[model samples]
Target chain A: MSRQASFGAGLWGGALALLLTGCQAGLRPIAALNQPLSGLGDSQSPSLNSNWLALISSRPGSRAQVQLIDRLRHAPVPLPGLNRPDSLPISVAVDQRGERLALVRQRDDRSELVIHRRSLQASQVVPIEPAGVPQRVSLSADGRVLAVEVSRGGLWQVDLLELP
Target chain B: MACTAVTALGLSGCSLWPLRRQPAAPAGLAAESRQQPALSGDGRLLASLVDRGGRTTVLLQERRTGRVLPLRQLRNRQPHSSPSLSWNGRYLALLVQQGGRRQAVIEDRATGQQHPLFLPADQEPQQLSLAPDGQSIALELITGGSRRLQVFSLAAMLEPDRAPGLLESGGGPPLQP
Candidate 1:
């Protein structure tokens, strides 16, 4: 073979090998967490921590309610006194042990932010000083700090509150 | 001549390669009706919003097994939204609507207890996120016709919920699955 032909063959062979390798590398399987659920009625607004998954789902007869799943056990954890028949859940956040939950719900024609202590079986109203409308909420890892989205004077702002 | 032949062969091989197939949806969930998805820090659980027959709700699924978990207390509540979970899937925080108003609440799976946080009468909550350790929370509120974000410290009131075998601030090799 001529010098030019030899060089061309080498180039083609190298390119083919590279292409095949690229295809193989791109075939990694998708993670199961990224996939969607089936049969459940209109499940949405998912939040996850290290070992817990929380979301709102409207199953057969229920309208909409918060659902908590233990990632390690692959089962749902029951929560008592959090969901009320007259209340509508808006947003949810969980702590590490699934002991403390921060929730926003609409009730009696008003919106409020509350901290629910599972062990104590009590709910405390987190008052936003200067009185603003609370929207979304997040809890720190230790459940020591809280981040709140508020609306004041028709403008949106973020507030950091100290929990006592 | 050899070079040309080799190039032709390469081209033919490329053409014969099959196209990559699109990934199929996980076994049962064929419809793409899910929304507002959140993943746990460990990536083992997923929470998302879905609508069924004009009603909106939340669903919690085990990422690896695609199993749907149950929420017994929330059965009566309708139109739930926004969800946040702790590191171990132990604490769950969410908002529930009551009449024409909304309230914030939390559920501790380990204790099977639910706690509700009440804001001032004038303050209205919009959205919220919980820290991984369940020590602090950030919330968005609307007051006086304006919106703002606030963070509250819960160290004084609640026990620290830490993940198992969690590393402090020290530097070390990342943990492997």
Candidate 2:
């Protein structure tokens, strides 16, 4: 090949190689999860685990409540006997099966922690020892362990409870 | 020689351009009045607290579709706060206020059962988080002017609510509830 022609081929070859490499290693578009959900009312305190999501929301002419949504089904799961008319839900956590829930509420004259069993249709009060006040609660994925924040002597402390 | 120089210039140009890219910004959810948002591990669901008509409530929405889900059981409760969800959204743990004090409770969605954690009259609950396995819970408590965080094992009290595929994958020995 002539010198000029060879130079032309080399330039084209370099450019083509660059183009092909760029296509192979190019950046991917943003994920759909990064997108925001619009047209929502005043809402806050969102918690998600796996395919389930739980949050607190209040709409016009409605009371504030804890809501649960199944991400796989894109629908709200019904929670019976969880919210009481005279009580205000302060915090909430959900298990993997959506079968067990742990929450704290203010009722009567004090704050307490309760566990709701779905299969048995029963609600039980898990008591804190040492007579300390309870605040926030967290549950393990297997529903085997519970972490709680307690207040004693005006200081914050964390306690682990083994449920039976 | 001219071709060689042109190729050199082109290769150098590529180096001059910035290569480190910034992460994409997260999309906005709603306007003001929304706070304390939590996302599931898979990023499929979102739960948030919204203020409406002077009351704070929990809202659950599918992140991809932006569809609002209903919470029929909590409709009557007011001023809900600090929401947490387990893997698959099966169990919801939260705190509620009744009368003058705050209480912690959990709602099981599968069977529509609500469990109330009972604390001593003097011990007051403030905030809480549930483990995704549905086996354990961590709570913040206040007693006699001090605050503390605690974790409790639920193996004896409640059955294991493991995520789908976890058990099949041999995650662990099943606990007898």
Candidate 3:
């Protein structure tokens, strides 16, 4: 009957594009992780690799997602396009051997910096360097120096002495 | 009838292609006063930066007789802001860090007084620009190994012998500091 309905519509359009690119790595990372050295809300910040985690969310509709937790196959993909489309993810940097990844985008007076290639499927868009209000995003201990500081402004014209 | 008008225009183009929802945090502002509002430079004043759980704040309002100023470095954590305003809003510029040190504050909310610009000890200034009757300020420093582009004078830190054209040629020797 018409080749079995075109092979079931090509296997349901390749299983809905692999279920929308396998929905942001569902969640699984716990090799003794405890991260909590301050910071709790307002759409979060402070996540360096493991246990330096800090993620805040304002919720209101929400838009920002990046999942990369393969602590040896615990699996949790989705890191492509590195969370664009309103890209309000603010922070995530784990370079210096943990493979490579740096992502941040802060609104209200601008701030954008991206660097990808952690692999959860990549096709492009992995450019870096464009500081603009970044405070503490260091990567050197043999990762080739990259530090930023714009800590946060408006309370006495501070830019944290202009770090490098 | 022309094939039922092309099957009702292909099911109305599939219900006019998805996403089209709006009507949020309006009708009298308060999803925390509609988030980002900053309206200084002669609009009378309005600023924003709020965070609930991680506790962040900065709201110098008065956009037409409403009066509100709870901007003491936005109390209780969650800083990392840059809420500026000083073309006639009286004065306000920020950068308040924690932990690895960082300080550069300025708030004059018509004589509320606040001024400090001190940074040196592993510089980490990731951009800041303000110049327009606000007394000059522009920085993008990153100390150690030259990555500077500074220009400031809120009556301080402008002494490259008092503005040697705001010092230039600050480069070389930094492949990654």
Candidate 4:
């Protein structure tokens, strides 16, 4: 075989190898259910008798979509984006009656807490501050209070606030 | 030269896997979650918060199956006037916040209207539960360095307060000053 032919074949082989490697990385599924979220994953699975709300990660690259699963049927629905545009879900929660939900998203270098409610059968959304990286949130039994857990300078504090 | 042949064979071998992959639902999940759950003390209903266009919302399921029927999505998705029940289960309550304030909404087993109860969104309230009479509610509230377990009379919570500022609960502030 000619020396040139051997060299060309080797080049083609290396190219193919690189392409396969890229595909593998793209297809890999990564779940970041680690240190940051605390035991949120376990505490807020679908089975808890209350209405379920979660900050579910959807296709990342295409869009950082946040999905809310109606625990009743396990179907996911999309939520609107944060005012920051690039803001993404950090934590999620539902009120006891499942009539309200709140999500904390980090955008730019700031944290923003957005709460949504379907009251009087009408839906409303608003951004609340002190919104730095929230770890977990839950609704009270009457769906009135919202308990928020936030880490400041690596220290954790739980805030029990009226969900106004 | 043999290395070239080996390489091609290796490439073909990898093609054995779905090299041109199709993105799929997360592993272990068979289908979209669609579960209308049973309400506390109530029989069967569904309730949850659903996110739409970056906005979040609470939803109610009024059937035994707890599934959002196809055409019903429209009515349910309507401007959602107030925290209403998705399904009217015997007993279900939801915590809601609107315009920087929080309120508790309780629903009976079979109605969608936001139940008129004591714990209206009139003042600051946190962690609320309906008592047996269904008239009263239990709440945990936080005010300037204090976390108090306040069980307000249902009627007091419903009616506008007599004095303004902060209503004092019986216990000496819970957390600390």
lDDT agreement with native, every candidate:
0.58, 0.56, 0.41, 0.38
**TM-score of the candidate numbered 2?**
0.43
True-vs-predicted CA distance for residue B83, candidate 2, Å: 0.5
Can you tell me which runs of candidate 1 are displaced by over 4 Å? A1-164, B1-25, B156-158, B167-177
Task: Say which docking band candidate 1 falls in.
Answer: incorrect
Minimum summed lDDT over a 10-residue window in model 4 chain A is located at A40-49
> DockQ values for all predictions?
0.02, 0.02, 0.01, 0.02
Model 3 achieves a DockQ score of: 0.01
lDDT of 3 by residue, A62-162 (tens): 56454443333433444555666755555454432354454556545566544454544332221122222442232221222222333332321111111
Tens digits of per-residue lDDT for model 4 on B21-108? Answer: 1111123222332111122222132343444454444445432334542222223332221232221233344455444555555544
The local lDDT score (0 to 100) that residue A97 gets in candidate 3 is: 38
Provide TM-scores for the models.
Answer: 0.43, 0.43, 0.22, 0.31
TM-score of 4: 0.31
> Which portions of model 3 show Cα errors greater than 4 Å?
A1-164, B1-69, B73-124, B127-141, B145-177
lDDT of 4 by residue, A68-111 (tens): 44444544444443223466555555554555665556667665
Question: Candidate 1: global Cα-lDDT?
Answer: 0.58
Q: Is candidate 1 or candidate 3 better by TM-score?
A: 1
Candidate 1 structure quality by residue, lDDT tens digits, A31-136: 2322322333445444445466566666667767776767556456777878878887877766556777777777888778777777876666655555667766
